[model samples]
Target: MTWKLGLYALAATVAAAPALAQDAKTLAIVVKGLDNPFFEQINLGCQKWLADNPGSEYECLYTGPASSADEAGEVQIVDDLISAGVAAIAISPSNAPAMANRIRQMAPSLPIMTIDADFLEADRDLRKTYLGTDNYLMGVKMAEEAAKLKPEGGSVCLQLGNVAADNINARAQGFRDTASGEKGIERLTGQKGWTEVEGCPVFTNDQADLANQQMSDVFTANPDLDAFILIGGWAQFAPQAYAQVTDQVMDKLKSKDLIIIAGDTLPPQTQAFRDGRSHAQVGQRPFEMGLRAPDVMLQLLKGETVEDPLYTGLDVCNQDDPGFCKDN
Candidate 1:
């Protein structure tokens, strides 16, 4: 079940956080935020597993900060969850470094793993395992899709979720490397004919409306921009705002004059692509992450080793493909 943490619980000490139904060992899926639909899919997967194994000894507890950008708040939630004596935790780590530091402080009291996002390589020993997308490769596929749409390589804008998120950073680096045809270039500005427009690569902090506004503002200011890459689906998460913003550039989208290769093919995002608002999408399987994480954590609790990074894989849909996310 989801966390019923009220404001008082959040504002008060860790003791204030409810430790409900201790009889059933808690297999918690603590995500970056409870708001993002991508994470919701993860929650649903956890719930689905619970429903399937009704007689199981463990319960899936999904909790997180209300706001995606609240890095400190996410850490606090993790602290509370650990104090509540949950059997295991699968953290998405909104801020990877902060979470890793916190994990270090606790020193692996209970089985801990990362889901969707992971800690840096130097600090990965803090978690038993990581279960999620190959973020860098996800970014590589994103760039590949954009390149397919706009082969000549022109001015581009990257929409990032969190500045400190290792996953997002990896995706950004992957995009830069692939798009520029230069491995490990810091920023994209006219390398191998691909350039990151001035004031581009706006960090959305995982705020949907603001991401849409930033996208609108960036595209409005730079109408000549050839490609827009959303490394996360922040803007598209708010479908109405995304629609309103992209409507202004419908002509360009229609003629393939501009390409928007976004990450995450949630229902709304997929629909947006079908509606011609976005050109392509590279999606991460959060549901699969959620579905498998509990088992992974349970195995860890049993002192069984799991894969270091268990990749759930990705799904790609492009403008040229008419059979994207459709049943035969």
Candidate 2:
């Protein structure tokens, strides 16, 4: 059959019959790292959106950096869901290039949508639609915010997702370009850390935490370290962790102040502010994106041709911003 015909058949097969039946139809969500509240929040947002839509179902599955899944987990989940005949698969790919082939292998009779993060060199031909923030721009915004906070400039650290992931790479590049261009900013590399207590497998949450701990040590080793910026959730938990380290380092330093900044927004980061742990966060509207993603996916499943790209929003949350007391 023609590609166009195949695409139609795929969307129709999912949207028609039980896929569009009176009861809810499943939209399998495959995501990275359920270790933190960030994923939980995103899941809640997606669920809320699906709930509002009604007659739609969702199942949450973790495709973390563990041995069981990793990128393979996401690919398998999509494949399994397709085989089980779910209405749609809304994925936040763990590794895009590695998983793209598996995603593309899905029967042309299935509707697939991506959100939160994207696959490397995604087959736009295979996906019904995509909904997420401009990750690179968000990174630039974070760097700009850090520059504003520290005019003199200093070393900034990156707490990344997966190094191979396209979205994180883009964000890191944007941050590196912006900070390196600044007269005084220096970019610091992150330490590989574990997320869980046991630290069995390396994950973003672990990497983020390790990045924070390394920054703390940097501050201890070099008391003059001026500013530290983390472009991941690491900064959210770093304040308390660093506060302890900073308190120890401060006793021996003439100048003991360090500025902390982060990229993504999470509830813990906001809480850190309440306890005086963080300075600022570059917030992505994940909840809003969640609500919108399903709407976009539903349209695609129904065979309504959508625009090539869709916008999910973002903003900066700081002490000055209203998110101070409100959940970020």
Candidate 3:
């Protein structure tokens, strides 16, 4: 499978960083967390790419923090990779702004490329290119799904992951914009049925226990909650988290009084969709993101230019239209 990046003229000269050895090139991929199945697939994709392209003169070094919210740890990992003289870096930032600043501090010296997530608008120049799903469109699809489930005006709550992540924020805003425009859907805000537990909506930190507790609290507080638009499939990641909500609201789910729509159809999330626990899953190609990053980085290292803000693609899966759901 050949991956083609749209070519462009180089704007600035990118100096190759000092490599570990002259014969082999070392590339680093820093994702949100290895614990997440999505990121695990990404890591596997990178491994597969390396295996397929054995003669490409590149070796991949993959690592990430234990938790998604460990911004400092992620920064340290990047610093360590830089110190080790990695030729290029592909990162899915936990915090976009911080990662962008860090990249800026090390720019030109070390070419940075983003995958899965992206940097902010003002700091986008720090990175060579971004390859991931259209997050805003993902949110728009979530909103459209919610409207489909409840055609006659119902309330919906959004479950989000890290608040500072550019992807999360974009998806949330997209959902809000599209859902607000729908006359039948009312996006709940404030502390009534749709409220934040601590300071924000279920910031799961990619932990199943935290996702379970946060979801249970929301379910307990909002018995009248018509639909849930989960921007991140944190609860579906682990059985314990899945049970936390399923055990509490199994009857409601069976009755079709409440609908749950989420993002990312990993094995567990796909099974949930199959079993009718979740109505739909928004699928993002994280594997492709990983597969393409090294290729893109290699191009940059060789003083070749590619298009900025490259989009992978997205799809919505359900019992009715199980598009990539069956593949999972």
**Highest TM-score scorer:** 1
Candidates in descending TM-score order: 1, 3, 2
Off by over 4 Å in 3: 1-23, 182-200
> What's model 2's TM-score?
0.73
For model 2, the stretches where C-alpha displacement exceeds 4 angstroms are 1-24, 54-69, 122-125, 181-212, 220-222, 235-257, 319-328
Q: Which 10 consecutive positions of candidate 3 have the poorest summed lDDT? A: 2-11
TM per candidate: 0.91, 0.73, 0.86
For every candidate structure, what is the RMSD over all alpha carbons to the true structure, in angstroms?
A: 6.4, 10.0, 7.4
Pairs in clash, predicted candidate 2: 10-109, 69-73, 96-120, 193-206, 194-206, 195-206
For candidate 1, the 10 contiguous residues with the lowest summed lDDT are 1-10
Q: Which candidate has the top score in lDDT?
A: 1
lDDT of 3 by residue, 1-328 (tens): 1111111111111112223335677888998876777787677667666665656678776799987768878987887888778889998999888877777776545788888888888887778889898998998898778667766636666778887888987888787667666322333453222322333355777666788777777788877777776788888888656866777888887777888889987777877887778888987877677778888899889889889889988867965788766655
Please identify model 1 stretches exceeding 4 Å from their true place: 1-22
TM-score of 1: 0.91
Residue 57 C-alpha lDDT in model 1: 76
Model 2 C-alpha lDDT versus the unseen true structure: 0.57
At residue 244, candidate 2 shows an lDDT of 67
Global lDDT of each candidate: 0.83, 0.57, 0.75
lDDT by residue (tens digit), candidate 2, 2-105: 21222233444324423234444666666655554455555555545543444545432223333322556657766777787777777777677666777666
